[model samples]
Target: MNTISAKYKKDFNMDKSIEEKLVIRNKRFQSRLMLGTGKYRNIKEAVESIEKSEASIITVAVRKIEYLKKIGKSNLIDFLDWNKLWLLPNTAGCQTAEEAVRLATLGIEMNKKLGQLENNFVKLEVISDSKYLLPDPIGTLKAAEYLVKRNFTVLPYIYPDPILAKQLEEIGCHTIMPLGSPIGSGQGLQNFYNIKVIIENTKVPIIVDAGIGQASEANAAMEIGASGILLNTAIAKSGQPKLMAEAMKLSVISGRKCYTSGIMTKQIQGQASSPYYGIPKLQ
Candidate 1:
């Protein structure tokens, strides 16, 4: 298995020479992996994992941060270095378009407090389902349209629906984030076909968010032409969050390299790698 994998990689020339940048609106990022500051054992572990992941963009749940601030408690923002990381405040707990729009305003305030005075990036999520945690397309679209009109860089999290993805893009959304599966389910790209279609059809970045449980899954997402990935549970719930974070970072890079190098076409029958015309006759 190792030899075959090595040979395949060599044939594909999946090296680290390709230079690709993930551009969302005016912002450009070298690292395509985005991490979330939640579900960790503690703030220290979360910080360490994020550092190890080397993800330049980190998402924070706006509602949670607001709650912490109201209670006079330090939140994840207090520890993160804003100069090194860009805050992507998310509307995690919002169930309605109004609620999501309200939380997004709070996120702008939070960014200003963190010294990101000009930051307007938001991860729009309007989810009412507690069991599946699936995003509501109508609510998300409403919130996205409102936020975009307000000059916010909207990155709406939605189910892997190709049509909806294009709709958000048409409305001036910076990026379209389609879930791999249910949030925190770690099912790993259950909606692979839909996501692939979105990537093929969309002009903006297509980030695969949620349901990625391992580094390999992250790699697979990037390999399938996803512009980036936003994940949390896979690293936070791992026994060694820091190590897993690093693994995910490498996986994203490896996958991107593979994608740029060009993946081989699938074949039904095996073809001899060595030239059959040059074979010596055996007695």
Candidate 2:
């Protein structure tokens, strides 16, 4: 063996192969998958699917709670294992900066009301275009700025724009959530280059949110340096939600492993695994 190869062979350790846990602020998550609570057939299915996913974080839209309370029905929070999971309250229906800010404040209040004392994180979303459901960058930034000052860990969901991403990071957003495609479209990485650029340029965690259609898409997101993925419609709308949830769990892990292992580079031409010089001739 060559001197360099022989030297490194003696120092290689098998114990250092374990994947590192994902950390955002003070919390560390074993599963980087973040599932959303919406559009499920029922609460039972949602609970089963989420349990199968083994996700460490779950997003709950605060706007739906008031209606549920008014109708004398249980909300998503009533079924969640509050102590085990981190609940990320989102302003899903907010269309303006003022509305988003109000919802965020009310979300924290509801968090305390539900006995989730440590819940100060919010997914800031201000979507002006209801037809496409695209994020309003101006409103999102405005809401994020307001929330950060009030000591809320703001994770703004936005369109994949590098400049906006940088601006959000500069404004002290806890994490940057750039969408893979239009909300609930299940299109999968429509703006991959922009998303990659955002991942490379931003200092904060980049959790790809919305429009993930399949397990492979989730895997690809993690492979390309996303800190995590937030998904809902893909699993919730599937015929077998529980099984799809399990697939998502495995896919995220697979993608994370591939990323951690340092994937091999691509080549234009074929490379032989065995040496032709040592091979015997065929008759």
The residue-level lDDT of candidate 1 at 272 comes to 78
Candidate 1 lDDT, tens digit per residue, 30-142?
A: 79999998888899999999999999999999999889978999877888899999999999999999999999999989899889998899999999998999999999999
Tell me the TM-score of each prediction against the true structure: 0.92, 0.92
The per-prediction CA RMSD against the true structure, in angstroms, equals: 5.3, 3.6
- Candidate 2 per-residue C-alpha lDDT over 1-283 given as tens digits, one digit per residue, 9 for 90 to 100: 4355765764564324346777777777888999999999999999999999999989988888877888999877799887788888899999999999998998898778767787798999999998999999999999899899888989999999999999999988979999999999999999899999998998888999999999999999989888889999999999999999999999998888888778899999999887899678999
Q: Which 10 successive residues of model 1 have the least lDDT summed?
A: 11-20
